[model samples]
Target: MRIAITGSTGLIGTALVRSLTADGHHVVRLVRRPPRTPDEVEWDPRRQWVDTDGLAGCEGVVHLAGAGVGDHRWTAAYKKTIRDSRVLGTAALAEALASLDTPPRVLVSGSAIGIYGDTGDRETDESTPPGHGFLADVCQEWEEAAGPAAEAGVRTVFARTGLVVARGGGAWAKLFPLFRLGLGGRLGSGSQYWSFIALHDHVAALRHLLDTGTLSGPVNLTAPRPVTNREVTAVMGRVLHRPTLCTAPAPALRLALGEMAGDVLASQRVLPRRLLDSGFSFAFPDVESAVRAALTDTR
Candidate 1:
């Protein structure tokens, strides 16, 4: 398969690109700057511009360009940046693909489990309606921005991703070192459910979305079972042979992360119902396996 990907340098995108190219697939990376390599394509979401010629012959496209939610303190301006980066970027990419003479067979646009905000102790799936809060709103808009591709009859799938557990990047990148040093603990009350998936599983799920013809709309990219923060702490301790005695109080976290802390502490028991029903299997289905995979860099 010849695939085109935005945010090809990001955590998930990087892994997906590696996995695809390793399997003899041609990968084109969409970048914001001028093309620096033969496979590089320049695009500007803010300007609503995409070099369509570069997208020619793409059998699939995985749109993953977005501002990191935890990259900066949630100031008003930075919040807008987060929203625009995903929503506007998706819209631009979708429009570009829709205008293509031969659109890709699949459009795996990025979404997040944050769409179901603060689902405390409640299991939610792709069928659930949008939740409240900033992330939820942004995710909703992000998925909606892909309307053009679906409207143009391209198979568009919204990958509502969960907390990716990996040593390479994302939240787990910071957590791995802390837990290894016995400095890691649960955030806030330590009871919030976290729906997590291993980096390998995430990459596989993306490929499944590209290859599976039946999948479309909001397909969650999460593990089967969701664990609480306390449970995750225990698993980390067990996996790393370290102590999990520390704790970050809610007030302290709120002060530290600003508005983003709420999301950090939010309880979302997301399940990959669609993925599972579609016969997708997880390499790491539980928190312990995921942590071990992250620590050992094993699939």
Candidate 2:
């Protein structure tokens, strides 16, 4: 498949591009600057501009461009940046695709498990209604931004991704070094459920979605099982052969992280109901295997 991707430099995007290209698929990267290579296409979400001609014959589009939630403390301005990056970027991409002479058959627009808020111990799926908070609102707008593509009869799938456990980046990147040095510990109460997926499985599931015709709407990109923060810490320690005894109190997290602490400590036991039902299997369905993969991927 010839796929055009935004945020192609990001954690998941980079892996997906590599995996897809390895499988003999053409991967086109959408960039903010002028196209530096034949494989790149320029786009400006802030200006609501996309070079449509460069995206002429894209078989699919995976919109993953967004400001990193953990990239900075949740200042009001950074929060707005996070919101606009997803909302405006998606809207721009969708509108641009809708105007294309040959729009892609599938648009795997990125969403997040954050949409469900703190799911607590209860397992939430795509059917769950939008949760309350800034991220939830952003997710609602983010998914809705693809209206043009859906209206144009394109297969628009909202891939609500979970905490991607990978070596290069994401939450695990920060955790790996800390865990290796015996400094890693749980966030807040440590009982908060964390739905995580291996980078390989994440890339494969995305490729599966690109071809799966019957799937649409909100499909979670997560492992079959979700583990608690404590469980993850234990697995990290085990994988890295280090001690996991330290603890970060909720008060300290709040003081240090501000509003971001809420998300860090939030308990979300998300499930990939649609992905599982659609027969997408995970290479690392458990936390231990995922941690191992993270280590192996790093090595």
Candidate 3:
């Protein structure tokens, strides 16, 4: 299948491209810069412009381009950047797909589990209503921005991904160094649940969403077993042969990380209800397995 993907160089996007190409599918990367190769197409999301014609032969689309939520301090300005990056880019891509002479059969747009803010001890899924917080609001708008594709009769699936347990990028990237150096500790009260999935399963889930014709709306991408921050500290320490004796109190985290600390402290015991219901199995479902998969080549 011929597919077009945005954020093609990102942590998840990069892995998705590798997986798809390995499966013998043609992949086209949508870029902000001018097209440098036949597999690249140019588009400026800030300008809200996409070359619909250039995307003519794509049978599917995955809109994964967005600003890194944790890349900067969560100043009011950077928060706006995060929201605009997702909302604007998704809206533009959906519009372009709607205008295509032969629109893609499916659109697997990016979303985040943050939509269910502070799940606390409660385990939520895609069917659960949105929760309170700035990130939740952004996620709501991010998924809704793809209304054009659904309205155009194309299958649209929102991938509400959890924290990916990959060593190369995302939170795990920073965690690996800290844990390896024996400087790692639990965040906040060490009780908040951290829903996570291995990068291998994450990439596979996106491809599954693209092919699952009957699946639409929100589908969470997370492991079956969610672990708390304290448990995570223990797992990291065990996996790296280190001691887990340190802790980052909530107040100190707030002081050091500012608004970003709230996210770190937030609890999300999310389950992949929809993904499981759709017959998808995780490659790394347990915390130990996920950690090992990220650190070593268990594949």
Give the candidate number with the greatest lDDT. 1
The regions of model 1 sitting more than 4 angstroms off are none
Q: What is the Cα root-mean-square deviation between model 3 and the actual structure?
A: 1.2
Model 2 residue runs over 4 Å out of place are none
Candidate 1 lDDT over 174-287, as tens digits, reads: 898998899999899999999999998999999999999999999999999999999999999888899999999999999999899999999999989999999999989999
Stretches > 4 Å off in candidate 3? 297-299
Q: What is the lDDT of every predicted structure here?
A: 0.93, 0.92, 0.92
Report the error of model 3 at residue 295, Å. Answer: 0.6
Pairs of residues at least 3 apart in sequence or in different chains that clash in candidate 3: none
- Pairs of colliding residues, candidate 1: none
Q: Which structure is stronger by lDDT: 1 or 2? A: 1
Tens digits of per-residue lDDT for model 2 on 239-296? 7889998999999999999999999999999999999999888889998998888777
